[model samples]
Target: MNRTLYDLAGADPALRFSPFCWRTRMALAHKDLPVETIPWRFTEKERIAFSGQGLVPVLVDGERVLHDSWAIAEYLEETYPHCPSLFGGPEAQAVTRFVNAWTDAVLHPWVGRLVVRDILDVIRPEDRGYFRESREKRFGVTLEAFVAERETVLPEFRRALQPVRLVLRAQPFLAGEAPAYADYIVFGAFMWARGASAFRLLESDDPVHAWRERMLDLFDGLARRSPGHEV
Candidate 1:
């Protein structure tokens, strides 16, 4: 409905594929909301840093600027209320919030560590040592030590998700039979830290893997576009 914001953000700003960015892009694509993308470099810190809280995927909506994925999701939901509700239903909104929060708190950190383990191959060779070293500094351990620590955290994540398995059977999306804001949020986080990072921890024939495919299918254009093509 709002074409001006998309018009201004016509270029893909960031070179990296962030899950949060992917989620917002997919959200817009799903609803057929025409928003343009501004691909930003990490070096362009001043502009986006001030607005997006030092992050990518900041939506320039005409005069209004949206920061954070949650805020963006809420904006889209409110802006396009009729287009296949992202919240799915009134009750499911709470579920979406929980799942999104869960991904941030539990899943993301470990995924980040796992990603840093093999950063040497992924990033520029010059940045490799720093990337690997940052994980050590953050986790207070080497890759081997971090992996052991990850095992401890991952089981809890896997277990916490245990209760949701049953609900998932009936409701393909996290909120219910349909997808919701939370599904997009969690899906984006996972897609970024795991999918984009291509972390080994995420590589499995697990339910989460299955869940990823299911969530993407809930939307239209995003599901069709290969990861990291347009938005």
Candidate 2:
């Protein structure tokens, strides 16, 4: 099958950083599917205009075109049932929905506050204006102002992760012993931070940090091999 993923990238082109795109990338990897990833920038909406939407992680798998990370995951699960399950079973898939929602609603906002400013440094200069204007209009502040108090709010962000920490304390992954779509949903946020900033979001001793390390090591360090900061 010819699989292509229009993934969000930075100025370097190799620097893929969108949290949603990471989710899809990790999902494709989890399914052991090989893909050709195209570097997509914010200003290059025309590149993906055929997908009928602007945002990427737009996957063209065979004759099917899909978008939205969670929707893409479900599509992969159903279309490739014989492949390793992205969601272990129907019951697990049902619960994974909550993880997906929490990551999108709570985790992403917190992470954005921490690293959205740094993203300006990584994206192409042409895209920076659009990124800044859009994000600042949404945030009602400049990128620097939005993340200025990250140090002060760091504890709040860590505290918000208690639910995830509690779970990781019991299992190797959010999806249980082995990673599934649930793990990827959360891991994608960290990947965004990794690709965009040098700031550390988790302490070395933190269980969440440990889980991220394991996640990075998965699939022969697929994520770790990507261009990103060590943190």
Candidate 3:
């Protein structure tokens, strides 16, 4: 089957950084599915308008069109049952849902505070204005103000990963001994940071940092091979 993904890209087309898109990309790789990713940008909404919504990570699989990372993951699991499982089973899938929710609600916001401002540096010139204005309005402050004192808040960001830290301390991956959709969900946020900023979000000794290393090594260093900061 021919699979294509509209992945969010930076000023350099190879710099794919959207956290949500990373989720889909990792999920596809987990299933051993090959995909052709089209580099997409913030202002390129018309390019993906066919998906009924303007978002990168729009998936075109055969004749079917899918949007949303979670929806695409579920579709892949059901459509390609013979492939590697993203979620171990029904019970694990249920738990993974919680991870997804926590990532979107808690982790993403925390990550945005740290690296969202940096994204402007990586995106196209046309995108910078929209990015700054929209983000400022949503955040109720300028991007500079929003991420001001990031160093001071770095500890809080690390503290927010306490749950992940506890899990990774006992296991190599968030999904038991191996990677899964749950791990991908959280890993996407790190990928977002890695692609857009040089700022270090994790210390060397952190368990979550180790887990991210393991994830980057998966699929023969698939995520690691991408254009991103070594941090």
TM-score of each: 0.71, 0.99, 0.98
> On lDDT, who's better, 1 or 2?
2
**Which residue pairs in candidate 2 have backbone atoms (N, alpha carbon, C) closer than 3 angstroms, thus clashing?**
none
Best by lDDT: 2
Query: lDDT tens digits, residues 1-231, model 2?
Result: 899999999999899999999999999999999999999999999999999989988999999999999889999999889999999888999999999999989999999999999999999889899999999999999999999999999999999999999999999999888999999999999999999999889988899999999999999999999999987
Predicted structure 3: clash tally: 0
Q: At residue 119, give the lDDT of candidate 2.
A: 96
Identify the runs in model 2 with alpha carbons over 4 angstroms from their true place. Answer: none
TM-score of 3: 0.98
TM-score of 1: 0.71
lDDT of each: 0.58, 0.95, 0.94
lDDT of 1 at 24: 79
